[model samples]
Target: MAAANYFESKCFLFFLLASLVVDGIVAAAAVPKQQRLDRISSLPGQPPVAFSQFSGYVTVDETHGRALFYWLIEATSVAEKKPLVLWLNGGPGCSSVAYGASEEIGPFRINKTGSSLYLNKYSWNTEANILFLESPSGVGFSYTNTSSDLKDSGDNRTAQDALIFLIRWMSRFPAYKHREFYIAGESYAGHYVPQLAKKIHYYNKAHSNPIINLRGFMVGNAVTDNYYDSIGTVTYWWSHSMISDKTYKSIMKDCNFTEEKSSARCDDAVSYAINHEFGDIDQYSIYTPSCLALTNGSRQHMRVKNALLHRRVSGYDPCTENYAERYYNRPDVQKAMHANTTGIPYKWTACSDVLIKNWKDSENSMLPIYKELIAAGQRIWVFSGDTDSVVPVTATRFSLGHLNLHIKTPWYPWYSGNQVGGWTEVYEGLTFATVRGAGHEVPLYQPRRAFIIFRSFLKGEKLPKSKRISLQLSFN
Candidate 1:
């Protein structure tokens, strides 16, 4: 009789376990497809495409009603097998939608007219599932009900909010929850990528079933160390004949680039170098012409200067920012993307002027975070566009010097096709490379080369070296 009772108990436990498993499956299946918000349909003016595109908001702060806008473009082919890449643009306030997606490496480029779109032959989406996010509360279509969320934005808060967004985003798109993921960005995203990666690493350690499969991160012409970046900028300007020797000397002698507040003498020197010396040229891409020519009339000078400073680099159009601004603000475009759902008070912009002015916190150095992440066995790649003076390759090189990492691969030229593309070096924990003539926006200046390097990054392979034509070997 006791044996019979034990068998019955085993059967009951087995049935309960099966029932729970069945319930879990049912619950997962019950998630409504409509709730997935897989885009109300395709966007108009978009070039014919095979991959799916989805755009919507993911609420990060319920109390403040803060939500982030995202545009996810699936890979052109075999998207289910490709890794997912989250691309952020750092102004601490820039719209990834406007810059990263529409103007740089996204699947489509806004036409010069701003009302049409063109296929980007070298879109990063061809290599991976690309996700562009407009972060914080005030940038692009992302917003918050509580006005303070805009003014209170900082590096830490932004990173935390982005982390929350990623978690919730994964919940909505469960297919990508366990997929390999990478975070990449440029300029100030040097802060955003590392901080968010650190948060994910911490969360993975604390949780039993980690959803985010964060594999690595990359930053381009990033502002990693402010002091190094400042010094490098001044030195680069001087070396490149963009500033007077006297100005350079004065800046070096009086400026403590590491300080939060610059000395008056330093400020004066920098102003002379940038304003008087560089003049009306685009500071971001010193080699590129300004979107609008500097007018001789003093009345138009300030406006021209602002336009130069704010313009995005596009090989095809210098006025890409103007085009993007018009494209995003259109009611039809917003409706198609399912953006501005609550009728936010302000129009969408490429960069948030208010957030930039009110930015509360910025770290001088992200090297320590890089060190921690590297030691934790995360892949790290730092690439620079050789021609970008704003955050020059010199700045990146100098900053990496602070890590004192052991050299794994000595610096060598990498090739794209039969021509030299850039120089690359591998350290014990990090890799550094330069896109030969590319500017602040690498993909904008050299999309094909950028795609090649990007593919190498994802594959954990060294960039290709020049091959003999007789061999008929191609890197791609």
Candidate 2:
């Protein structure tokens, strides 16, 4: 009788254990119902990773069938606990996937042949869940059924659509509905980030309780004030010796900084600088080599493709945009990533020429938006890559100078490793920093330092003031 009872208990224990295992598996496979269709199991040539990735379109306008595309790379560890970061690339027409994801901060960097993928050691996903958005209707895989939408794209519509994307996207991934969120981008994104932040700020205010918990925003080498950017860019060209003194003088005299549009003479002078004086050097990163595949005797490249200026050299691949273009256009890759299901006519390009040419409305200055958000006690950080001549550090400095915010923490050298990472100044409602030796895309040029800056920005902490290892956090 005793032996029989013991056998019964052991059998019961085994059954209970087996039931638990089955339950765990079921739960593990259970994804949000709305997100199930867009979940990416894996990408072609993507190395194995513990974290899951999701990419697909979110329809912002049902009437026009305008949908924006987003790729969400969950945090490396504890994604649920980490903050969600929305990254936008500014071309007024550029694909964030091509510039931000494949090249700058995303986890994967396309190989030279564009046939394989490799991990970016300094990917921003290491610290936060990074969401790369192909914003507006006409950039990358994001599209609009209404042909007029492309020609009508502007700052107002882009911000509205992006807000809608986030609202609907949060519903799809309810896990991140109330998570601390941030907006980040570079170049033209300088305009996008703050404008979107202002929208979210007001949106949250009107609602009693909002799902979008926007913490702050950061922009690198941003186009802040049109007046400052124009003047500052011309100054950068001459100061860096990229243009002759005569050309600089010509731009200053011909360009009316106060006007919404430049004079034809100003345009002529600027063109002369690009054509006669600038040579073939990459204006984005004056020090980096231009992508020969795109630049060699291509007038279209000189005019359209130069908007994003995606280039890198030395330790990084110079033809990253080409690789991204090839990899993203692959049928298998698109199918796996669940992109272009509508069979769009155009081949994927980095920046959309149609949208760029048709950009109808752009705010002359984001200073008013900055002041509004700052008054609301929003966290605002502006950073710049020192080596970029197009939207140079000087341009950002000139724009921010218009803010005239009181400094809290005086300028100081912030350390990443043994060397100085960059210099930072804490303001009453904002922070400004510069990444040393960094180009147009700071993360692509100095990933480690950029990551450090990112972490600091997120935590609302000043960068480490010392070289001592104890002061700085270890990052992968």
Candidate 3:
């Protein structure tokens, strides 16, 4: 497969010339691997942790070029017979390694000293084999000489390149070929993951073989439907008491809620909401307050300026704190991430980029993909972290509401630690879960809850029942 020349240019190629130098490299011994291991082992009911680490470059011919970069992470357990999860982080041009590897599901996290690995007690590798990829030929360590390569990074081109990457990747890890594969990611990946999954499905039908035997996928507070995603942001602010009802209502009435134009009213609505909701506004945490609480400092570490700090080499971090500044102010990080900065109209901390990007303004919604998958007998699950304002549960419900999935089971709370923190419902082969007190990143925010959901997913079991509440929703 040859690289497609969708968005590359000599000028853009020059833009890609930036190089990454490891900053604040720490000695390996200083990291407390044993501390984390001991803590993890002691955790009650924690799954046993294990992994097969692999790192290599995948070359794919796309954008009239060969794309190459280091791929890292552990495969699923050989004993578990679980699915293969290919995870990505969305910047359209962000480092999956920075967010996907360090912050979220991958097994190892770089210590505050920036040297050595610390075992994340709640790493998602427990449920399935996971792979983290740096993509688009210029993001992170991925490189290219052709400046034009940058121009070729539209949704379709990226999806195509990703498929090529997958095919070649499987050749190196052949045991995973037959594994139930799933593509999961966050942020702009709401677009990337689904489109790639759809393409994989399309090719399988065309080739008459299940090379990409996709089972199901989940996106944590991801962006899918633009209108609802935009409108829901305002409503989430109001619900959280971040904005006054009057302010929210006015914005709801005046703002178009379309992704087409960036509006002042929309921006004001969010700002107004943020100012009224919390005290000590300058230091508020962006993700759920719980995540930032543990960090015990405003910066993730002293070297880290703010949680959302975007630097060329420092990498893409989903803000657990300082979400506002991270999204809007970080210049070097945005450039390195290959962000389509032209799409952005105003200063935004979280969703400003997508709001201004070259999005598909089509009347046709995403349900067709869902309908096709369900009709083809594929299982699909849509889960959300309830507290996330970026791609809030309300938007997910609004997007799914258009589908009007017939309720096979009523909505009920699902459990972890004898407490009800998530809601679950099954409809046909699809299930929807909303985890409480969680934000944009579900696994990072609530690993135990994520594990419970994942366990039921692999076993094809119904949603777990909460002891304190009824298992079924009373729709009547």
Q: Highest TM-score among the candidates is held by which one?
A: 2
Clash statistics: count for each candidate: 0, 0, 23
lDDT of each: 0.82, 0.85, 0.58
**Poorest lDDT segment (10 consecutive residues) of candidate 1:** 298-307
Candidate 1 per-residue lDDT, tens place, 259-310, comes to 7777778767777776688876666677777666223331111111011233
What's the lDDT for residue 301 in model 2? 24
Off by over 4 Å in 1: 1-35, 293-316, 467-476
* Model 1 lDDT on a 0 to 1 scale: 0.82
- Among residues 3 or more apart in sequence or in different chains, the pairs in candidate 2 whose N, CA or C atoms overlap within 3 Å are none
Ranking by TM-score: 2, 1, 3
Query: Between which residue pairs do clashes occur in model 1?
Result: none
Distance from true location, Cα of 42 in model 3, Å: 25
lDDT of 2 by residue, 221-249 (tens): 99888788877877888888988988999
TM-score of 2: 0.93
Candidate 2 vs candidate 3: the lDDT winner is 2
